[model samples]
Target: MPDPMKVIETHWNSTPVPIDAIIRDIGLPLSYEPMADNISGYIERTDGSYRIVVNSLHPETRQRFTAAHELGHYIYHRDLLGDGVGDNRAYRTEGTNRPNANIRPIHERQANSFAANVLMPRHRLTDVTDESTAALAVRFNVSQQAMAIRLGRAG
Candidate 1:
């Protein structure tokens, strides 16, 4: 299978990652629901189709990240779904920190990494001459913190 970053680049083919279009292209319907503030999003297979619902209460950046994170679950952990996968506070607030034992930390970490990579691709970072995380964040339509994390991990 292609890695998440490659999938985002080759399949999506746009800068700042047109995540909504990609979701739709992949045949996953996305909706914004008024979920608990701490809940980012969830994905599930229903009626032979997949749906992704993000917390509408969150900021646009958070919602975008949540969508990408949930997409990661759909791409990498579909077999692990049980009543669907719900990501809560720890997964969202903690950048790279692994979640506690009760949660599937590995899956959470993978999804987070996937979200980061998809949102701010490494190749795109290299093409940037500004070298400002904030500017890059604006360019990528992601939060500054998320951009920093992506820069730190990028080659």
Candidate 2:
């Protein structure tokens, strides 16, 4: 399988990462569904194809991040998903302030990293003039926290 970041870069080939277009190009259908506040999104394979459904109640940024996260799973861990996957299963996004448990599964961590890399590609950050992480987050259309994590990892 290809590296998730490389796949995203090849598919998007632009700044701000046109995620919707990438999804369309990849033939992964997306839909919005109302879910619990803690739930972010999920992916499922049916008839040899995949579909992603994100929680509509979340903010747009969260929704976008969730979509990217699910895409990460679709790209990286498709084989692990037996039939369907969701927040109730092994795939789930962080909910709220939970104390450092140091128990986050590896797949979740990978998906988060994949999402961050896709949304805030390191090449784009290198060319950024503004030093503010907030500004970069806005430019990348991701949460400030996500940007901060990506900056830390990239630097």
Question: Root-mean-square deviation of each candidate, in angstroms?
Answer: 4.9, 5.4
Model 1, 19-105: lDDT tens per residue?
887776677789998877767777767876568888899988888899998898888877766446667755633332223333377
CA error at residue 89 for candidate 2, angstroms: 12
Highest lDDT model number: 1
List the lowest-lDDT window of 10 residues for candidate 2. Answer: 94-103
What would you estimate as the lDDT of candidate 2?
0.70
Model 2's TM-score against the true structure: 0.79
What's each prediction's clash count? 0, 0
In angstroms, how far off is 5's CA in candidate 1?
8.1
Each model's lDDT comes to 0.74, 0.70
* Superposed model 2: Cα runs more than 4 Å off: 1-7, 10-13, 88-104, 127-130, 153-155
At residue 59, what lDDT does model 2 achieve? 78
Give each model a TM-score: 0.81, 0.79
